[model samples]
Target: MTRETLTWLNTMTLIGHTDRRGTAWHYKASEQGGEPNHYPGAIPLKDVRARLFNWEGVHRRVAVELPASTFTEATHYGLDNKPMRWEVIGNRSALDRSDRDTGAVFGVVGPDYKIHQYSDWLLENVAGLLHDGLSVSSAGLLKGGAVAWVEVSVPENLMTDEGVEFRPNLLATTTMDGSSATVYKRTITDVVCDNTRAVALKESGAEFKVRHSKNSELRLEQARDALQIVDTAADEFRRQVAELCAIAVTEDDWQLFLDRTVPWGTKTGKPDNDYMRLLKEERRENLTYIYRNDPRCAPWHGTAHGVVQAVNTYDHHVRLPQKKEDQEPDRVSSWRTDRNLQRTVDGLFDELDRETYLDLEAVLEQAA
Candidate 1:
């Protein structure tokens, strides 16, 4: 596909706990990388209601915690008023005596994920195809409440004879934390470890993002047309993967790729210290492993795809210490690192394509 149009697949799995009120209700989020702004904390039910009325807009789902003592335990009724097995709480705030106390009400409830909603949409969009042997193999939330995605895969009988199990998947995700636009892209998931890398050779027609905004509902309604591009996307991805597989790489070529993609020690003519050298050496090793191991790049382990995977896997899986920060750089959320790595890969490929003098020959030679 055109480098000019390529963008990052910036979405994460939705992480949540069953508890919907108080501090214990929310799932504990890691704060390794400092993301003070997007801390995954729960807000009170009242505050959620306030936001709803104020038109502030929540990304996906909202959770309300009703204690058993406050409300009447009545038989659960579905939207159709049919009685369900489970008991349902009737009044939410019956126990709360204070009515006018409008202070900063903070607790753990949610702007949690709308998991069911997302799943229903996916099924409705592809119901007819699913009946024809295609199925949803994997579905989950990514990066603590940042995004939700579902991967619909081709039937096992229809898989390509690509030596590896490289199947075309329709990866659909919607962002809840406003990290990036909601994207429904056609991609190939390496079924081995479930690693999904965006298919880069050609852009899918169904692969479009709806930016998070006040009019997100309208945008979602529009996304139906985009989601229908699955068949075309799957065909193109197969073609592209086949092309990449045909190309090959050597050890020297791999080294050259590492030289080009991985950052070496800075050339300030200052003390080329032991730590810097160690850092460079570790990165070199990590890149080498990713190049060799990632299944998505298995067919093209020495080609452009391999190099991109090396960078991506390094950033996404490898834990590297920051130069200034005391702790190792933690991911801001689930898909932040993935998104950043993809962005880097996108830019590198773009430069390689457009710039005539951007080859790794010189970098490789210098290292030699």
Candidate 2:
């Protein structure tokens, strides 16, 4: 249908995740008015086909018409000296497609725009991962059927000696709304906090992106080869985690980090009034509490990795939208969280030198 026909919250969205990560964000399916969409294990390919993407996006030509008011007696007309009630205009409208009742108009595109069927996308990108012990851990749609994603993960989780347990995942996403190009990327999820992180140290080369051009389908083999490189991402991530764990942070250093990362006073550098000071103190206290006691962050408390985990946990779980209406839908929130985590990861490494505390301070300063 059209966007006006759908509710703002939870319209034409389905999120299913394997129970390994607990329920898919508890409130994701609340508007669906039934049980939360949680599966016992990896979701089967057949189930995904049957339940989520049964329709295709077919392109339809668009046409335009003009009213006859602009015509004059000088123009060729019928014997009445009046033009037709409506005249056919040039085809100025762009072609686009959607499932008549179940999806929204995906995008307005030119003649060269290709319609990549979801079925073909899945078969070419995701289905084969199932055979290699990588299963579909999460899959869903958002904004009607304009965007879709499937997350695949290895069944066996990995842990560093310092006790950071994580699962590396391949996130394959496509959007008909032109928000992004078709992308297959590598990401890691911290099991303790369920926060997503980018697997690559640098941002540029981690994912493969294909534009929606006529030659999109022909690039499938190259995409698969890129994914083979993605498959080895966890090893490098493990090495980095171990390195972070090896860097020790003293109590004094932790306090300095908190001061720099969560500065006192206001953004203008003015001294805080009583109420503002209380709020600021509460923020610091909450972060310190998470650093000292939260299971997600405390296990590696004396190390650099612990500081990173503390900040990530606080951001993911402790932070809240200022207004209830400001809350994002689960899919939108998930996408934003992944991007935030990646920034945190990249920011930390960009400032890390592994030799001095000043480098660590610089990292937190930049992060703040």
Candidate 3:
């Protein structure tokens, strides 16, 4: 094939080659599409996805579509855009069981934001457990003065299994309110598990800086209190995300994020009040079709609004934020909503609420 410039959007993957059925997902690019050419060849997964996403960002317009042949040399349309093809060059074996999949492989790995996130979760959860020790003996627990607890008897004046005896006797942090309190015996292991989980829920974030005090009881108390702090912080985190989602889903903030990268363009780069109004229109699909670089598109300046147009085009699109706004916005023509973020926070709340009140000792269960 003769070399030619593809200055326009021309690199959309033909769906004919890739496979997607019922529910099984595929992220492996080489396995998904294109001729096995050398693919059963070597191509960087990132390279393939970048083309897919950039094509998506471009909104998939084209100057000349490839013919039926699978041998088109994927090269840059822009004078500076990098070439977009990969071919596996070589491979060898490492062990009898392990085959060396290493070759002149060309591609970049997807971002590792997910792996770092899971590591963070582990650090938080473990810190909570180490700080808070379990106090199994509370009110409504073991009646008839015979309990299944570990039974550490302290001075009558010092903290007791129940708590300090005051003018009004303090309540036990852990309690039992089952059918027959006189007959039921709460196991030490069960009580310990509950208290520890409560501690984990409360102080998951604090163990990072707060040192464990030399006093065993003090350390436990600190751990338990920290859990409560973690609970409130987690909620605040969610509410903030929700607040930002308004800008997020709408790409209202994209102008700020975009300004850092996108170049000034021919467009007016101002928020199209007229365009925001189209979002409220009755039939938006038709409106969207008209909004993609059409004469009428001048009004669609919001990041989310631009995204809707990109979705319609299956092409790459970049919108420069209007410099007129008080806060310079950023570029993000494609954005996705944060799914299940609130649900995770709700689960954390449920765990914290399990134990909530006490005069001084750790709260074993909800106060009555």
Write the candidate numbers in order of decreasing TM-score: 2, 1, 3
Predicted candidate 2 versus true structure: per-residue lDDT over 1-368, tens digit per residue: 12211122233333334455665343345454443345667777776676677777676545333335655622355556666343433432232344474334666666667766666675445675455657777666655566666677777677877677788877777766555667676677777777666554333336677788878773557656655655787787888788777877787777777777667877898988998788678778987899889988898888877777777666666665444443556434544433333333233322222222344656546555
Of 1 and 2, the candidate ahead on TM-score is: 2
Error of 1 at 56 (Å): 14
- lDDT winner between 2 and 3, please give it: 2
What's the C-alpha lDDT at position 78 in model 1?
A: 49
Q: Rate the local accuracy (lDDT) of all candidates.
A: 0.42, 0.61, 0.23
Strongest candidate by TM-score: 2
**TM-score, every prediction:** 0.50, 0.72, 0.17
Give candidate 3's error at residue 351 in angstroms.
Answer: 27
**Residue pairs in steric clash, candidate 1?**
1-201, 12-142, 13-141, 13-142, 13-143, 14-141, 14-142
- Per-residue lDDT over 1-368 for candidate 3, one digit per residue giving the tens place of the 0 to 100 score: 01111111112211111111111111223443453211221223333323321211001111332322233676333344444443332231111101113322212122211111111121222233432222111111021111111111111111112211111011111111111111111111011111111212122322223211222122445434444443333333333223322332223233222222222332577554665545333223443454344432323433232323232222212222233331233212111000111111112222322221111012111111
**Best candidate, lDDT-wise?**
2
Per-candidate clashes come to 7, 0, 30
Candidate order, lDDT descending: 2, 1, 3
Task: Report the alpha-carbon TM-score of model 2 versus the true structure.
Answer: 0.72
Q: Which stretches of candidate 2 lie over 4 Å from their true place?
A: 1-19, 27-36, 58-97, 101-111, 201-205, 265-279, 327-368
In candidate 3 the C-alpha lDDT for residue 65 amounts to: 29
